[model samples]
Target: MQSSRFVIGVIGGAAAVVAVGALGTHLLSGTQSTTGLDAHSTVTVDGHKALSGDIVAGRAQSRYHPLPWVGDKVSDVICPTGLKAVAGATVTCTGHRSDGSTVSIPVSVVKASADSVTWKFERS
Candidate 1:
């Protein structure tokens, strides 16, 4: 009876250790981190023609500065479908106006990729 009890206790302790180890590994692996990044959306900033002007989207807010520290609402654009404007690829932009003016603009790719990008104006 004493030997049987010892064997059972050893098994239970081993199982608990394995479970804790697995949980710790999963938490430290960083497989569930997002950092609020939307890689599927394209990014646009100010002075970028075509995408410039007043625009709005989710988590997209801007504040302009004219004086020492003035803030005004601006616009930002997100592709959400990824962009193909690579080092050699060309970026074609279209301008939309509620009035009546169609502007077709082309943006030369200075630097681009498929993973991530930075938008000076757009946040998400």
Candidate 2:
């Protein structure tokens, strides 16, 4: 019947509109892609960019290893207690140098992988 044809046409039109909307959303979201980073890499943290260094794995658990620096040179870094290195988490890590000086680096987790986590440093 003509009514059946009309109902089918309406459904098809609605499906087309939904498909177009989904495609548009995907295209727009692609512009916000992130800068890829991994473990043992250097990223900016609170104006002081440094390497992520190694992770301290103890009893089947893993965490970012603390860094050690010599004088003005960059070295190890440590995040505060309870601030996990998961994606979207913000943490302030203290950079330790050999000369007994410490610097605070504000970092935000961007991506967390199986073996490493990437962070973006925030400017003070």
Candidate 3:
């Protein structure tokens, strides 16, 4: 009977040690992590938003590509035909105004800063 009690006590102590170690490791590792858009977006330059009166500059390929123009909200606004808008790539975005007029605009993805990409717009 005494031997059985000793074995059980030893097992319990080992389990307690393991649990403590796991908790300690988890606490040391930390639980705070980046989430949402900040998790997927990357910034390669400085600044979050563009300054006023920034000129749009860049070049696009000849082959036409589909680029979606999202509204202020995440809803689908328009799908414009142009080059794919990538980091440091120039693309064209054609959108329709509320006045029933179509407008083709040149867009440039200059750089991303602080989880946001800077864009320049020009009339075409």
Local distance difference test, per candidate? 0.35, 0.46, 0.39
Q: Decide which is better by lDDT, 2 or 3.
A: 2
Query: What is the lDDT for 23 in model 2?
Result: 79
Q: Cα lDDT for residue 94, model 3?
A: 49
Residue-wise C-alpha lDDT for candidate 2, range 1-124, written one tens digit per residue: 9999999999999999999977765553321123324434445445543334223111001122111211133346555432234677665656654577766656565666544555555322
Candidate 2, which segments miss by more than 4 Å at Cα?
A: 1-72, 82-87, 112-117, 122-124
Clashing pairs in 1: 41-80, 42-79, 42-80, 64-72
- The alpha-carbon deviation from the true structure for residue 120 of candidate 2, after best TM-score superposition, in angstroms, is 2.8
- lDDT assessment of candidate 3: 0.39
Per-residue lDDT of candidate 1, residues 85-104 (tens digit): 34433433343323444433
Q: What is the TM-score of each candidate against the true structure?
A: 0.30, 0.31, 0.30
Error of 3 at 109 (Å): 1.4
- Give per-residue CA lDDT, model 3, range 1-124, as digits (tens): 9999999999999999999977765554331222112332332223333321111211211111112222211111232432222456554454444566665555665554444445444533
Q: Clashing pairs in model 3?
A: none
Candidate number with the higher TM-score (2 or 3)? 2
